[model samples]
Target: MKAVTIRTFGGPEGLAVIDVPVPAPAAGQVLIRNEAIGVGGVDAVIRRGTLAMYGFEEGHIPGSEVAGTVTAVGDGVDASWVGRRVWAFTGVGGGYVEHAIAAVEEVFPLPADLSAVDAVTLGSSGMVAHFGLAHAHFAPGESVLVRGAGGSLGIMTVQLAAHGGAGAVAVTTSSAERGDRLRKLGATHVLDRSGQGGGADAPAGYDVIIDIIAGADMPSFFAKLNPNGRMVAVGAVGGRPPADFGMAMMAAFQKSMSFATFSAATVSEPDRRAVRTAQFDAASRGELRTVVHELLPLEQAALAHRKMDAGEVFGRIVLTP
Candidate 1:
């Protein structure tokens, strides 16, 4: 088998493709012949060694989600899974390969109408967007603002909010053209990356903020939340905010606003699986959308990381093996 690994940590050049022995499934696991792999900001963070504290290191394969066909099942697994097309979560590594292993419990059956590219796009990201909104207690007709609305997660948040009955769906993006693109995706208003609302038509405050970037600017976005609003920070792609950032929330004590960080890990496995399966079904039935920026070969993993670092990718970049 061939796989991409981080030979060294720093630039995209650090990712090198190498030959390796094919791995077999273990107890409660399944072997998948990967057709597509997802690349996102977290991959770049891992490549840069930002997550080294979490056990990432040299020679680590960096990928989280994949869509493929199950070639075999391990002990305690059902034979019916073999030869089934499905989406799998390969943990934090071992996904950038021709064949990957996933726990049987982490694999979800795919709709025949969904392509491999679409499966990878909506599989993991859709789960986060869906659960994040629910965790924030978003209600119908409430206003939504998605910070860093350029990746798969942000794109899904915009569509879900609008389809779920948000009165206004606003996004903070890099350009007018991308904002225009998001509007077509159901965004009601656009804001620049600096936190400036698009125009006078923009909502003065948001009822719910689904923020993907949590850096120095996070506090500013927190301030935009309406009284009694909830803000959920799901990703820290822009880096961590200052240690004193929470003080801003305390200062607005009278507004009764709330802030908290959200991770899929906080959700029960059964709940996550159910939500993911429903999202895949929705996309297959045309009730949801998956935005893919480009498709690259598995060998071009380095190129994919470079694009992500340059902020050139609008949605997801799928690597076909």
Candidate 2:
């Protein structure tokens, strides 16, 4: 077996491919021959050793998701799982390889029409976007905004909000080309990445704000939300933004709006699976889509990480093994 390992933590170059013995599945786990892998901004963060504050050690793999065929199942696992095409969340690492192990419970059987590339890229993004928006709900005909709506998560948020009955969908992005795509994806208005409504016509303003870039522009966005509205911060792709408690509280007071942050870990296992299933079905029907920038080979995993970290990636980047 071959796997990309991070023997040292510093930059993307640290991701080196090496030969290793095929790992056998432990009890309640399954071994998969990976067909594709999912790469996102968080992978870069981990690569840069940001998570080391909590003790992330070196020699760990960097992939979080993989789509492949199960070659073997461990004790207490169903033998029928063998040879099933599926995608599994290989939590925290251990996915940048030809074959990886995943807990049996994490594996999801794929639909016949779904390709491994699509499952690991767009399919995973849809599930994440669904889970992120689960933090707050907007009523039908309500105004909605997807802040920093240029990345994979942002793209999904914009599409789902529009398809789910948002009367007005607004988005913010740095790329003009991406802005145009967002409009086509269901956005009624597209604002510049730093713009806070400005001359744009907003109907009662944004009733719900799905923010991925909670940088210095946050306070300005907070001011745009309608009274009693909610703003959910789901990402910080623009590096860590300094949060001044007093300033945020003042903004909240001005509009009587609520603010929260969501993570997949906050949701129960059953709820997560339900959301993943619904989003996957929606994607298969062509209702939800991912803006895949490229599908590179597993050997170029480091290059994918570089692009993602540089903000050059617009959507999901899949790596095939």
Candidate 3:
């Protein structure tokens, strides 16, 4: 089996492609013949040593999302799933390989109409978006502001919120060119993070604010919330945390607002299952679309990482093995 492994944490150059023995599924596990893999921001963070303490040891594989076919089922698992197509979140790292092993519980049957590339791209990002929106208790006709709206998860957030009958606002630093793409994805309003209209005026205070980019603008975002508004934060791509928590707190108190953070580790099994079910249901109904920005060969994984690190990607990047 071929896989990408990093012996030292650094840049994309640190990721080395090599041949390794195919892993056999142990008890409660299943071995998948990977057809597609998803490259994510967290993988870049791990590669750069920013998230090194998260239990990813040296010589570790770095992919978390995969869409493949089950080639082998371990003890206690049904043999009927042997030839079934599946998508999974391998909590640790192993999805980059030709064949990866995962616990049976982590895998879900893929929809027949969805391709492996799309299924892989929807793995972690789509699930997190679903979880965050659900935690916010989103209601129809509510208003939502999604920061980092040009990214993969952000795009999913916009589409899902709109599909649920919420007014969606997308915020991104990308030029008008990319903002148009977000608008087409269902954003009622597109705010350029680099312009004056970005945070200058709070248009019709948002009922839910999904903050994927938590940086200097967080206080402003909090202030824009209506009474009883909820803010669900999932990612921090701005390279730093908010430096003005006092202001944020004051705004929250005045507006009777609530803030919640999402950690994939803290998501319960039931919640995870619900997300998977919702994603597939939506996809089958054409309410959900996995916008793939690029498709790279598995060997070009390093290039995919570089694109993500530079923040040049508009949507999920999938790797074909």
Q: Identify the runs in model 1 with alpha carbons over 4 angstroms from their true place.
A: none
> Tens digit of lDDT per residue, candidate 3, span 127-151?
8887788889999888888878877
Query: For model 2, what is the error of residue 128's alpha carbon versus the real structure, in angstroms, after optimal superposition?
Result: 2.5
Alpha-carbon shift of residue 235 in model 1 (angstroms): 0.6
Q: Which one wins by TM-score: 1 or 2? A: 1
| Residue 175, model 1: Cα distance from true site in angstroms | 0.8
Off by over 4 Å in 2: 196-199
Span of 10 residues, lowest total lDDT, candidate 3:
194-203
Steric collisions counted per model: 0, 0, 0
Ranking of all candidate structures by their lDDT, best first: 1, 3, 2
Top lDDT model = 1
1-321, model 1: which lDDT tens digit per residue?
A: 889999999999999999998898999999999999999788888899988998998999999999999999999999999999999999888899999999998999999999989999989889999999998999999999999999999999999999999999999999999999999999999999987967899999999999998888898877898999999998988888889988898999999999988988888899998898888889999989899999999999999999988889898999999
List RMSD in Å for every model shown.
Answer: 1.0, 1.9, 2.4
> Comparing 1 and 3 by TM-score, which wins?
1
Relative to the true structure, how large is the alpha-carbon lDDT of every model?
0.93, 0.80, 0.81
User: How high is each candidate's TM-score?
Assistant: 0.98, 0.93, 0.91
